[model samples]
Target: MSWFSPSRLVPSRLVPSLPPYSGPYPVGSCDVELSAADLPSPGSPPPNAPATIAFRLFYPAAGSGPSRPIRWLPSPQKAHFAAYARFLGAGSLLSTAVSLAPNVLYYTTIPARRNAPLLHPPGPAWPVLVFSHGLAGSRNAYSALLGELASHGIIVVAPEHRDGSAPMAFVRAPDGGASTSVSYQIHPHKPTAEVYAARDAQVRIRGWEIGVLYAALEKIGEGAEMRNLDPNLGVGGVEEDVLGSFVGRLDLRPGRVAWAGHSFGAATVVTVVKSAYYGGEEMGGPFIPARDAGIVRQITKSSVLALLDMWALPLTSPSAEQFFEKQLPAYEPGGAGGKAVLSVLSEAFWRWHGNLNDTKVVLAPRTAVSDDDEKVEQERRGPYIFYPEASAHLSQSDFGILFPWITGRVLKATEPERYLRLNVRAILQVLRENGTVVAGYSPLEGEEPLDGGGEGKKGGDWRILNPEGGVRGWLPVDMEVTSEDRRMSIGEETGGRNDEVRETEVLGDVKL
Candidate 1:
């Protein structure tokens, strides 16, 4: 897929377009809701009330016609547009005006067919990937990436977690009546500590929500009835449908499941997996408690996990030092090839410090773990670390790809390539290492070349390096690439704020 041309960045004439999926299969998508009567809310909600999870499912399609385009934003109604416009820092009048103008509000199209037939691959079942969005992000926020993965014969399930963390989510009543749209509210007066505590709490709740979704899959695997549940609980513009196609089509095999998340969602994956590995009490943090230990254990026991530029590591209690030295190296073999953890981070991840100002704070120094430590785990786990230099925190989602045109600022506009490469690498790594699906491409192909050069003999603009040696011999590269601190300062004037943060603050008072 070709990168967006420079001419398409004009604000008045720009129409955002997602790059085509590189996989051979066409993509099919549907929305479904899961209601677990026994699942308890992690936070202070009604205990007996059934915990509900609404998600969009993307999978490979059997037949291809003119692709069905999906709305970029979930709610295209005037009310939602006004709220989102305000959240984006538009003035009241402009927000109202933009809401009234439907053309300007709903312009982007996701290149996937809705309610298309699910394609059965050569295997007995399709590999499953559960995706969690970042704070204030919707399930469709990463539509491009998720759709790409789905096109590659992977089933991508993204839950619309309405734990008061997303920018907006359609909250369905327990009785399956009308769904109400909820928007994120900013409380600037709330103490910083209180805010952190609330975020940590939400992280745990979202993690448990993931567990509930997995349980639903298990039920489907057992041939349980899923159509009896409410199917009209639509999110954004997409309506929920019957689960008849997905009933026997899902691959719930041990080690075939992979967990992936961005930002706080990434942190949630880590928390849940860590709690399962070491008892919740031993990990001692605001969110990891004994109550969630069982759920975490069940979710992470045999699943491959991936963290995309995690934002909650600093706020968590168990240090990476403790996790790497004790749990990571001591990982016991399981269905997912001994519990592998792959983190595809961006350069700007190191500069993040919540809403505070500390550009030099290293949130994930373990990316540069010692050669000895790397060697120990290399044999057990696959390449445990990868960071792309030409990317930011939002690069993993559609927002990063479209932001350049939205704001008319061309900083790091080539990030779509970086995101595409890194995302494919992460998926391929998990699949290849777990012995689920092995394709021809190397997981490390097309990464940003670290050496000061253009394309190398390996046909990748970036270099792929191994901890034991400089570059993989198969690539035929000459230079030795070592892990370096990719963290960069935006200068004292910016006070550690990346472009994404600065842009968000400028658009609205929301603290993400």
Candidate 2:
């Protein structure tokens, strides 16, 4: 066996045909009421200007309580404007109104389809979900998924990661002149480790901020209606505490909290959960009254229920095994003195488990094989199979953030709406595990039953089935690669013109 330097697999940019580069919209702006008089007519041009890439939100009605919103945060790739336009064009069926309000987000509190009157007040507390944008992305990247989730009962928070989002600055080309711009945070000599380190730092920081903000929102509640209208408030400076409080103004339960970020945001949630737990630990058992320690112990046991990573890859893979085996000195077992918290944190995101119980896991591209897999066919290109050189960006904190862009280029396009409807189930699973509501008959009408794997099954019941088994959409796809089999690639993109050789070394039989 031989060792390879870690710097050779630097990520390179592939300029796809241009797409719409919409910025993050304010969470308050989405307003689509089909019953309202301001809707657009079919086949007619939009009566309103297009707002920042559009999305929808749905929550339970008054009696049912507030639910989470599924959020769609899109990457800001300027070239894809046309694609976005087409998306909205197709999405009109979900709404009666069409407006392109630049910089303004569109939000609506809708009830799920039960054909009931709108008299019931929503339930007391609502669960929470946050959508994270990818590198060089804005907060409104995935309108397809966001709108669909909002249509249900989820409170979705999409945060704009400051480190690598699309900037407001731009060079306007002269009339009929073309403009060119590079991706945000682009680098010549990309260090995979440095990039991962930076992303983890940024996402964790943002996640903590998000948690704080949401807590504040719970306190604000209905006060938002009053404060939201004030003319003096600035959009960016509006106290997150105030915003948090305002959203929380409605009397409700904190319910369950869940975070799902694309790309780096995914990594962000994982870090923040650990951070929240760590912080809670430091706070000394929740400040309970002298006798409440017993209750506190049980309560704090599983504060965080589940973490969902959409297309995320571990930090240093197949390679980390050897580095631990040969290069790095071993730590004295269980020695707090040797276990540096930050170092572990730096590596915290290097490897992650989407399941609450770290052992059970779900990896994407179920069909995609890694270079280390037995059927390492060079021609096959998809996540099911991994290629050492292909996933150069795995080192970055937010891996799924690039889902839209990456999914756009390499595979057949799935309607964003369809994907959202399917993905929300996984989120609900997280909520259920967190002690939230059970899957009501209404929400589970079309859901499939697991053959042998879920709560109902006894032996070897991992088989989950959808109502339509042949076309099951979002089930977990597990791969053979474990923490021990993955490796890291370091180096610049080789053969500038050659698309084939993208890495410095290929570690076979190693976990991806």
Candidate 3:
């Protein structure tokens, strides 16, 4: 069943392309890295002095010519492999074994073509999404999800957090000297005051890094030359001005670009969006206010927010009380922000009652008990929330697809590709309802690509987002998780994060 012998086959051969982008357009990818000095800042750089900002751009691209596929592990494959092994808690022996197969990783490539030109959509410009990776995640961590979104005509700018969250990174110097090799920074699994402080520090750095990325997008829209750190980058349309075509093709206008992330990355999305709209130098705590650049204006109440398995602990730090106290901008006084916001959790997180309660508390107003013991309920449009059946924390990410055997056989997480498709469908539908002009794929039952040409009801994937409409095991979640339910969940499963799971995995299926 493989190009090589059974024993000789590797992870790359098992899962060649990143599940295949189920959309109308071809996806193209490029690695762009910039330091503070390289950025064309009209004003001063962001605070926290983030050394470098690096990410992969996955966008709808011109499919005419031939292109080499970008490798999944990037350049210096051995280092990336070892770093991932360590991040996953593979012992020294397993880590060395993983590093020994650098060639295996080199052969593995996602479906996207390398450096292909951006496709010219019918609209003024393509909607953009600034995606943040979670702990043990790189730019390509959520390729299956982000790349799929790009295939449907969205430009996804996925940032690699150099705040010691990834396995390893070779950050380029501002002056183009030898690259700085940064490795993963580990914090205790326990949620102690010390852990909270460390996470807050990381969150601040992550938040500021996004501010710098926003500035870079602003420059790219103006046709500015951003010196990408990768020396071996493939030329797409021409050798020079690789980023030229995006001059007027990117929708970088205020309140246009969207925010998204997974796990800790999801928390980053919430914090940054909250900071952009509500927090400033005047209002302070650990929140990195968005006065640094255009972030304050770019991210508004109307901006679409898609959080997948948001890790609540980072937002729970006592230092961030000023931030956690405020409701999501979606609930902005008389604003239609709720429909655009969505949170898709894996079954694993839904079962972790305490974290589930915390996640709900942040996204929407919770049920309050009156002195007379009656539940107080109001007519509020909370962010659409749901969980796919038989899914794990890593299900929304590339980990499930890239390592199918581990996630499937060992972990019993069935339908990795299907669940991701479900997620893509729901998010795309939410985007559609939120005013983004990306093409809608047909219903999930057919698992079709983006609808070609004619606009019809069949082209709308809105049913997937509807609570009454049936999707593949995507059940409408009860937004109001009660105090009694949290107590019961503690008895059913461990109410803590494991290795790196936002909500630590509990083995058996407990009926929700």
Give the candidates in order of TM-score, highest first: 3, 1, 2
User: Candidates 2 and 3: which is better by lDDT?
Assistant: 3
Whole-model Cα lDDT of every candidate shown, in order:
0.54, 0.30, 0.72
Q: Which number leads on TM-score?
A: 3
Off by more than 4 A, model 3: 1-16, 38-48, 91-102, 235-240, 290-292, 366-379, 443-459, 481-512
> How well does model 2 score by local distance difference test?
0.30
Please provide TM-scores, in order, for all candidate models, with all chains considered together: 0.71, 0.45, 0.86
Residue-level lDDT tens digits of model 2 in 1-512: 11211122311132111122111111222311111112211111222211112112223323233223322322232333323333234433211122232112112111132111122224554455555554444444444344344334455555544333333212223232443332344322243666545444444335434443343334344443322221112233332222332254232332244445544454444344333333333222111112222111211223332232232322222222221122111111211111111011111122322211121122111234467743333222212211111122222222122233332233222332233333444444434434544223132323445444445543111121222233344332333455533332222223332222111111000111
- Per-residue error (Å), model 3, residue 230: 2.1
Please estimate how well model 1 matches the true structure, expressed as its whole-model Cα lDDT: 0.54
* Cα lDDT of model 1 by residue, 112-164, tens digit: 77767677677777888888887657777788888877876788888877766
Superposed model 1: Cα runs more than 4 Å off: 1-14, 38-51, 64-68, 91-102, 105-107, 187-191, 228-242, 280-302, 313-339, 351-383, 406-411, 415-418, 442-512
